[model samples]
Target chain A: MKSVLCILFTFGLWLLLTWSLDPKVVGVGLMMAILVATLLAHIYPDNPHKALDPRRWFWACIYFPYFLVLCIKSNLDVAYRVLHPDLPIRPGIVKIRTRLTSEMAKTFLANSITLTPGTMTVDIVGQDLYIHWINVHGVDAEEHTRRIVRPFEGLLRRVFE
Target chain B: MSETIAQWIIGVGLMFDLLGCLGLVRLPDVYNRLQAGTKCVTLGTCMIMFGTFLYGVAALDRPQMAVQALLCAVFVLLTSPVAAHAIARGAYRAGARLWEGSVIDRLGEDLHGVRPPAERAEPADQPAAVHHFTESES
Candidate 1:
């Protein structure tokens, strides 16, 4: 019941986001989301075959909105750089460590970083993460990761672990 | 009911977007700024987009633009936070610190092999280690 609700919630948000009142288009999108989500469920089915983490979903709902705001801000920042005379890109790669025990949270975090603009998740070494950034304030790994992650930890704590 | 109202909404939305950008520039560090950039700015842009959607309805029949703009918003919604998470994780892996100034890392107790309630039911942490990366250490 919970997993099914999760799928429905995901579908509803997606539909609202698309903002297409065109029933045909929305219906199609909803159907697609359901199909993929259901298939995913089967691939990791309930009980003995699969385990569902409602906490992760809860965290996902909480964390996702905040990330959206960051995206918009970053998008504008990048746009400014493009529009301005100086591109001001100070690209470099750095390494950092994590306290996240579950590989699931780590992987989600990795992929999240990649999706954001001007930053990339290069690799993961155990609990450590390797990132290529468009800029660096200093050479300290702990400081940098802390800045990047403070927004995420609470919701993530509720989520993928 | 009037163009003036639409104009006001649009202006407010733009201001929200602008304030977010300012936060991005002024915030102390990457992660802090990511908060300013991601949360405040995201709200600003969404508001701006929403105003435009309304304006389209009042001025022209460009509902398509509104819908498409909405779709763009959706894509951003699904992906942005995940991206931040990814970048944070990446930065952490790559040696970015939270702050030289902060004291508590709550994760310390949770991490020292103390499993979360979510993973405690089964003998969970049993995935085969992907590799022995000692050779890669310099």
Candidate 2:
């Protein structure tokens, strides 16, 4: 099942990248995708059936636009800080816990945090993520988790977990 | 009309790129610099690619160019954060210090085994740690 999913994914990527529908091109793409999937499918550890869930796809679609808006807002915030004279930064590394158990979900969470407002993930030790915040408003782990992780965690849980 | 819109978007993107470079110069330390540089540049470059896609589709009438440009934008979005995270991790592991005005250093504390007692107590439901042994130890 995983192999089939991998093959389909790889072939879909090939089609998108090539943007061609010619039979010869498609045949070659299918062959390559099969070969790659056979070699790489083992690395995909999650239940392959999860990838077929329509609800996850719906959330993922929602996530992209939501993330874009957040990205733009954060960029403007960063721009303000960059252009300001006093700099106004109170940077710090704080540890926050994540409810995400899977490695893939944790990775997505980390990447999202890095790209989001005023935070960059410095390290992930067990369930705790060490984040560098440009503006340190709080000290405690629960406070940091509430402010930093809460926003994305629900959405990510629906999509990945 | 589309050409003008694309030009404006590309212009704004260029301005963002400039600010990100300024950030690289102005920020205090490695972590701060990475934050500014990575976030700003990633968005800036992705916006530029988006502009290119619009230009290709409407101005040049080339769907292929538009698709490729959009793909580039997506690629940048997916990869930039990962790259930034790796750099941050590497810098920390390499002993790069945070800025003087920094308020905390949880990662450093964790690495040095100086975490507060409250944090040291693990929940009973938490999974057991995995240990790996080298040839000699084994």
Candidate 3:
């Protein structure tokens, strides 16, 4: 019963985010969503632990605005560095110690870091997140990676595990 | 001011993408280089798409171009990290060693006992401590 609801919800969200908003689009989207949901249910559907958590959803709702602001800000920073005569770039890969225990949190952190500019999570070894930082600013690139990935971890923990 | 700001944003995004490409070529390790390629290119391309979107809105007045730009942005958002993960996992599976300066390898000693290729062929006589997966999975 809950699985059906989850599938419907997931499909609905997918439909909403797609290109069209018309009734035909919505109807097609709904059918596609159901197919996807049903396929997902068959694949690995029985984890009650993956259920909805209000706190996580609340954080997710707010996180987007924060991400947008950072996206714009990072764009400006990268542009400035690009145009500047100095050509500021300290290229290096750094390993960050991840404290999150849950797999979902770690995955969230990994994806979120990639979402933001200037850093990418290239490798994850257990709780250690190996990141490639484009411009190694200030003293601690490792610390910077940790600081950026930290928020996503918290919200992911609340939601998934 | 707004026009200048928009120009600055587009220019910077392009710069970062350029830097990212340079780093991907210049960096020492696969992991390090992948980072440059993934984040920098993804953001840089995104900026270009966004600039196009802005131009579409302010200049051409075409909704289709803006929509296409947005679709590109969404596509980048979804695939960049996934590609990174695939690269990292492929590297690991192919036995690429982690950096020495790394502070910790939480995977170190925690595998269901999967050993490196070199260590795997040691000896059947060696006890459970360095347990071999081949012998056990059978």
> For this target, which candidate reaches the highest DockQ against the unseen true structure?
2
TM-score of chain B, per candidate?
0.67, 0.81, 0.71
Candidate 1 differs from the real structure by a C-alpha RMSD in angstroms, to one decimal, of 13.1
TM-score order of candidates, top first: 2, 3, 1
**DockQ of each model vs. true complex:** 0.06, 0.56, 0.15
For candidate 1, write residues A33-109 as lDDT tens digits: 77767667654323422236665566677777777666655666555543444435554445667777665667667
Superior by lDDT: candidate 1 or candidate 2: 2
TM-score of each: 0.45, 0.84, 0.57
Ranking by lDDT: 2, 3, 1
DockQ for candidate 3: 0.15
Q: lDDT tens digits, residues A1-161, model 2?
A: 88988998889888988999999999999999999998989887677677799999999999889888888888898899999987888888999999998877898999899988999998888999999999998768999999999989999999988
Docking class of 1: incorrect
Task: Give every prediction's interface RMSD.
Answer: 10.5, 1.1, 5.2
Q: What is the number of backbone collisions in each predicted candidate, taken in the order shown?
A: 38, 0, 1
Q: Once superposed on the true structure, which residue ranges of model 2 sit more than 4 Å away at CA?
A: A19-39, B115-138
lDDT tens per residue, model 1, B1-138: 745676776686677567557656643345444544554455566666666777677676777666766766666545665666556555444434333222222232233445443343233443443221121220
Candidate 3 local lDDT, B22-63, one digit each (tens): 755554456555655666777788887888777667677877
